[model samples]
Target: MRTSAREVAVTAELNLSQVRALEVLLEEGHFGRAAQRLHVTPSAMTQSINRLERDLGVRLVNRTRHPVVATPAGQRFMHQAVRALEASRAAVEAARGVGAGLLTIGFIDGYSQAESRLLDRFHSENPDVRAEYRQLHWEDQVAALVDGAVDVSFARPPHSGVDTRLLDTRVVTVEPRVAVLAQHSALAQRESLTLDEIDELEVVTSATAPAEWTRWWVIDPRPSGQAVRYGPAVSTIHEAVASVRTAADSGSGHVLITGESVGQRASNAGVVFVPLVDAEPCRIELCTRRSDHRPAVQMLRALADAACSARAKTGRSVQRGAEPGVGVK
Candidate 1:
């Protein structure tokens, strides 16, 4: 009789740990060491090894041998056991890559604090899903998404490896650019500063950051036609802040041009954040993988859209982020 796929009944699973113990025992050539390999008591190993042989209805090991050599039947079973473990590992790894109930989000420097409301909403809608956030450089965010490390990201767009083709965005808010300087600097007294004043100071920028991103963040294109002078190269926002403090104390006058919101989070007592009222707007985009069609992605997008819409009715600039600058940390 021919059996359909639906008619085939699968039996309860074999214990993989016991099978692994058997394999390790065969490889190690000792009972005490095999027990140590599996982190089990020697008695437990004896029980499991016995149970495994009994389950198969065959004598696996030659108990008379002091070294415990495998019987011919056990030797034959060893090959199949190896294949079984490989198949089990392959299935598990493939399933993990699918990202079923896991929702991963990447954010640039300060955006994590901005997206809390949306996250709260997302958790409310899908309480069973595990939500994780990775804080990344402006350049690394998109690459993280394309590599499947993250399902969505809150970051600036047009990244090198992951451009419009690899990602889609939902605009949460747009913010003005700001110049960060030492509080003691003469320019810090002013409520607002223009790009020309920023151009006069040596620009402190990141060495490890992507060129295009650094150019944009530091206002590479100047109001004055003179070539911009690059000051020091830093690796992180914390490092940038440290440099700003150093320059402030020394009166060397180093400046960092960054988004208004990021300036707030990264600013300290020594750093004064002054709005560059005329600089181009910094768009805070909700970036998600274009090919992903998971429930968590859809739910997050919906929550962001609702949040943006509600904020629009109030005629407010995105404060902090879409809501507030301090991150969950």
Candidate 2:
């Protein structure tokens, strides 16, 4: 008797990683590339495919080709794998009650002060609700929120070239942008500089970041319409700083643009921050998916708004020499 595709039983239990590997391999069409995407070695990717094929008792990939091709059975299995992964993610969200029990928050590196304050307020109001933080890279900020990897994120704005119709944002703080350069660099001696002065210097950027996002961060086109020079493309904040330091050490000028808070927190020995007198201020916002209307998210958003308002009021009060309020309302 012939068994249907759904009726076929596997000899071994397949894990989510294996399913994800198969999906990525098919999408990338190359073992090495797939391995890189999944942060695994090429040999590990090969072994995973071998195990998957062994368990399923069918050849899933045609390995003879330069760019791999999925076999007939593999193509059919791929469809199911996609659905299976989706179901698995849904099950996890369901188990967590989608922010009812746990609220996973994502934040970019060097921008944790505001997140910590917000979490403090959230915890005070929500004693029983569990919350955790995840550090996100510049390129993955918006994607993390959209993919449900985090319930919410504290990140910079202009998610450029990304579809954010399903996302919502609230401006938490608008801080000035600063230029980061090597401590030994000539520019570090200057107290402040304008964008035009740094326009000629190469700017460190992310390799995988959206073009518009990178442009905004680097302020690509100046008021004079000259294009900003691009330097080494880095994947992380540390790499960017290292590139700048290396260039500085070699007597070559390189710069990185980041928020004032991040610049002030630079603990790296060779890095120094200088205020950008003419640059646009960085807008740090609380980003959340529009589809997620859970109470936990709403509470966090309200607290963010209240905190921002209180800070603004306090700043004005201090400027006017008046006493500020005691706690967040």
For each candidate, what TM-score against the reference?
0.64, 0.67
In candidate 2, clashing pairs total 0
lDDT of each: 0.69, 0.74
**Per-residue C-alpha lDDT of model 2 across residues 164-283, encoded as one tens digit per residue:** 555677766667788888888878899999988887789998888756678778886776577778888888877888888889878899999988877666548898889989887766
Candidate 1, residues 15-120, lDDT tens digits: the string is 7777777866775567897787467999999998888876676778887887677899889887567666555643553477464477667876756345766777
Top candidate on lDDT is: 2
Q: Which pairs clash inside model 1?
A: 320-324
Evaluate residue 208 in candidate 2 and report its C-alpha lDDT on the 0 to 100 scale: 80
Error of 2 at 231 (Å): 0.5
